[model samples]
Target chain A: MAFEIHLDNFTGPLDLLLHLIKTNEMDIYDIQMVEITEQYLTVVEQMKQLDLEIAGEFLLMAATLIHIKSRMLLPVSDEPVEEEDEDPRAELVRRLLEYQRYKQAAEALEALPQLERDVFVSRFVPTEIADSADETVSLGVFQLAEAYYRILSEVPAEVFHEVIREPLSVAQYVQLVVRQLADGQRHSFRRLVAAWPSRAELVVTFLAMLELVKMRLVEIDQVADYGDIWLKLRVAQGELAAVDLAEDGFGYG
Target chain B: MADLKRLAEAFIFAAEAPLSFERLCLLLERSRPEVRPLMQELLTEYSAGQRGFYLAEVAGGYQFRTDPDCGIWLRKLSKERPLRFSQAALETLAIIAYRQPMTRAEVEYLRGVDSGGVMKTLLEKNLLKIIGKKDVPGRPLMYGTSRQFLELFGLRSLEDLPTLKEVSALDPELAEAVPLEPESDN
Candidate 1:
């Protein structure tokens, strides 16, 4: 009770209790209830005085200790103890034992050769390519969804008014995105979505961009999180043929 | 034997990930009994050599890894982030690893704290996985250590884990818990 206790020294109440028992060098099977309970309460009180955010489980353990202490104080009959009548400290001792087992196991685990610290695996490093080769920027789907949500919020409230007579297809949006990117021009996704008059049109255009990327006709690039997504025309041989064919006679109303 | 050792070393070195004995055997067109000793010979050869790398059996497989003595230099050169685990996370993970098919409530009971946040972090890191649901009253989800756990800790399998008794010998409180005979009562 006289010693200082840092909250960080122990993971939780059980860890603190185990530390107390070990430091005292008391036999766990025959833990001195009155002494242990008093020490336990003092520690909890000290934690409270320090304004530490003691978790509810700690208080619950304190209450259980107090309950066990009070139970031990009750007068016993002159008759010999029955088999069913167990020691008050049995459950607490069992829990402490179980927790101690795991604490040691954790220490053993920590002693193992951890990856990247005690061991290093081989990492495949791609050979440097010439600047002439195309570089594809990959965006995580989560980031793509976040950018799409931002665009969705920017759509004017009035766009929801008219029930669209015809829902624009993904193919139509794909063609629309291709036309916008004609002549090897790069366009920000926001700018492309802004050009559409209705939310339906914006959504379709977004889908079209996804399709283009999937088909290798276009690539989506972002420099950082929440950054502007850039759409570039993929100039691969197969995509070149498709772009040329689309340019020949494709027109959108 | 030297030729086989060289072949095994090349296969393990060129592998993108840890290669299991079965995989190596299949690749070499040799049985387990034949390939295992050759791989072991390769393991000893690498460790005894002045090479910067060593062969390790981890994640139920064998792989070539940089020598731990060169870890600092390799980390500096590669700029690979170190995997960090808080004390609480380690405790929770240890319990799960030793006692798989355990529910969240069981973990909380053992730790005597809310392990939900730590469990979530472990799940996100792929260190812990929800194997199934416990057939209890509410049917809470059961969690187990992922294969990534073994890889991270350099353990070949659950059998490779240090026994509770062995660990307990290091701590007085833990040593006291080990019963001379198994208890039949729950």
Candidate 2:
């Protein structure tokens, strides 16, 4: 029974060739090169007619098959055969067999009781114990400065200095940081400070971040070595007021 | 006196990831010699096939998994879309799993098709991982099957994979020509 093979139906040319061989029940050990080549070419022609994007590998195999057929057609000499002389079909046959083995292995893997597919494990997850195991290391002053400097380099040098009508206060910047992380998400330290329009405000915000950390109002954590420092609130937004920011002596200007 | 089997069972039951022997020992505060028998007993009890779920020694650890037949009903309840593997994907995965630490070019050579897309899909699925770059001049990144591959396939380890059957009655010379190592093809 003849069948129409689509491009998507087979993985590649060798797979297609195997299918052809299996359908015809041709002996793989002794592949009838002439017959199989004709059948393979016909399939390729059909694929072309259907406008299927036949892979170059298929054409390569087609050429190999024709070459084998032509070699087989050549008259044989009566001279003694050498020890190392190999059949043109030998390499092709070896590859087909090798491919067939893996194809079977793939079938075996498919048949196994796959996790999340044929079988399932318990979805039970215990309530997380307070994660003292948090891998985040406390951000050091040096690392924080390095991160701040990286952000500073990206911001263009200020074109004109504005009059210091109202100096940027550490306390106000402290409140700004608390508000930024009030959503309880880890905001990148560089990204948070980089929002300021000028170098002076950036420096004031950096000092405010240090002030907040000292007062235990916010925590700076580096999740990985040399990774970005993240600023997150140590206390809830309501508790930020209770933290004696005044006691820390960073008075609001 | 703590029933070690019960404690181990509880740990395995509650664990999302497979509970390893080392972790179990640490959790139980028991010596390896003491824990080994209890774990074996637990495994044996589950292996009797009397329970709804059995303890599977997968990915070098123990996990409680329901029978494969129960998946149909489980899928209905959970509505997790079953992971589908295409012919190409399966073949590509098989090649990598067996002859892994090989390159995409090598995989293509075996499958006789471009496998970059297939390998990428497998890598995305976490079944394959880049072990390291091959020491060759181009230093192409080598790929290997991940622990997730074993867990998904219900294999305890790579050693748990079924031994590939020898190709029967093949010429010794032709057999020798089947190069397992990546060779510099001229």
Candidate 3:
């Protein structure tokens, strides 16, 4: 039977294989190896023609399918086959069954009332909780890491003739960031990094941002993926100097 | 009876998050058996009243949300971006939810692709979490769904999940592919 195979329609090779088997209405336990292998190869060829990036795993499955087909072609022994020497398709069948189970489960999940879809919980927060948390916006550490890498790439590679140690600590950077945000306005991460002249200084600045976040002194926000990161001071103006002094003393000691 | 339903509605409406039955009881100073029926009564009343909002039980709690039919209008007003999940991520999440404490290698074997990137995204989103390491040869990390997942999916609990048979019945082709009885240990 002719089946129009679309690589995008299937999650991967096994999904495609399962589709083919189901479309053909062949008993999974009693698969027609020769026919299935031919169909599988055809799908792979189509994938190549379409210039889709066929992962190594797909090719490996193709080889396995061919091997199974070849084994099935060999003459059967007159003596009864041992239980350990099970059907050549046993391993593949087991995997397909396992995958199918999860596939079904996923369908069930999709059918449920998803948040922000079928149902939405109240976005409202009790005033007390909101005040205590101070509505601080934050980005994941991963985003900070990305920002660090971008800044690092901008710095020219250094070939040092002698080891130069700079007395830079995370606390100092925290103070620097707080001073920069003294106006209580938001600052972009790139802007913060741009103020530093050297790669070492940039590193210290990034470390300080991390420290500030840990101390709940600054809030970081990223609106979207790979988007600009914004940082703002969390503490009030009156407490800023006190925080700076405390952090500085802590850093030096 | 009318007074109690209105009170339940007001409580659910003002709450910042889904209000659990226990919390509702505590706030109302009522028993579990007393609060549940009141909530149900409110749910039925809203459905019958054909209001713009309805009472929904999500994340093991009751909350007042806009009716699905009014979703477009709500989106226009809020302008909030809806969450989107890729097909691969959903499938992987499903496997993790059902067969968890599963290893990455096991998920990859079932998926027939390198799921490293997808898994990382799920972890970053706080949908899936590393529960612990499995006691195997390499001691691969085991993953399971996070509480965030339950909340995001609006599931009260894992028990709220539909059976495989029920889900597969939605599609004839899928029903044929998935056996009525799953023999795998997972």
Query: Residue B9 error for model 2, in Å?
Result: 1.5
Q: Going through the candidates in order, state the TM-score of chain A alone for each one.
A: 0.51, 0.49, 0.52
The residue-level lDDT of candidate 2 at A112 comes to 87
| Model 2 misplaced stretches (Cα beyond 4 Å) | A1-3, A80-84, A126-253, B168-186
The weakest ten consecutive residues by lDDT in model 1 chain A span A244-253
Query: For candidate 3, lDDT tens digit of each residue in B1-186?
Result: 457667777878887667788878877878888877887788788662287777767667877766666655566555667777777888899988877888899899889988999999998787887777889898888888876788777667777667655322123458464342222353
lDDT of 3 by residue, A2-93 (tens): 44554676787778778777766788888899998898988788688889888888899999999999988888898988775778898988
Off by over 4 Å in 3: A1-4, A126-253, B1-11, B24-50, B78-81, B166-171, B174-186
Model 2's CAPRI class is: acceptable
Candidates, DockQ = 0.23, 0.23, 0.21
Q: Rank the candidates by DockQ, best first.
A: 1, 2, 3
- Over A139-239, each residue of candidate 1 has an lDDT whose tens digit, in order, gives 43333555798998998766456664665566666777777787677799998888887878877787678767876788889999998899988864455
The CAPRI category of model 1 is acceptable
TM-score order of candidates, top first: 2, 1, 3
Query: Taking the tens digit of each residue's C-alpha lDDT, what string does model 2 give over A1-253?
Result: 2445555767788877777676666777788988899889988897899887878888999999999999888877678778846777888888888887787778778888888787887774544632443434434333455579999999999899677655767777877877798898888988997789688888888888889888787789897998878888888778777765442478554
Q: Docking category for candidate 3?
A: incorrect
> RMSD in angstroms, all models?
18.6, 19.6, 20.6
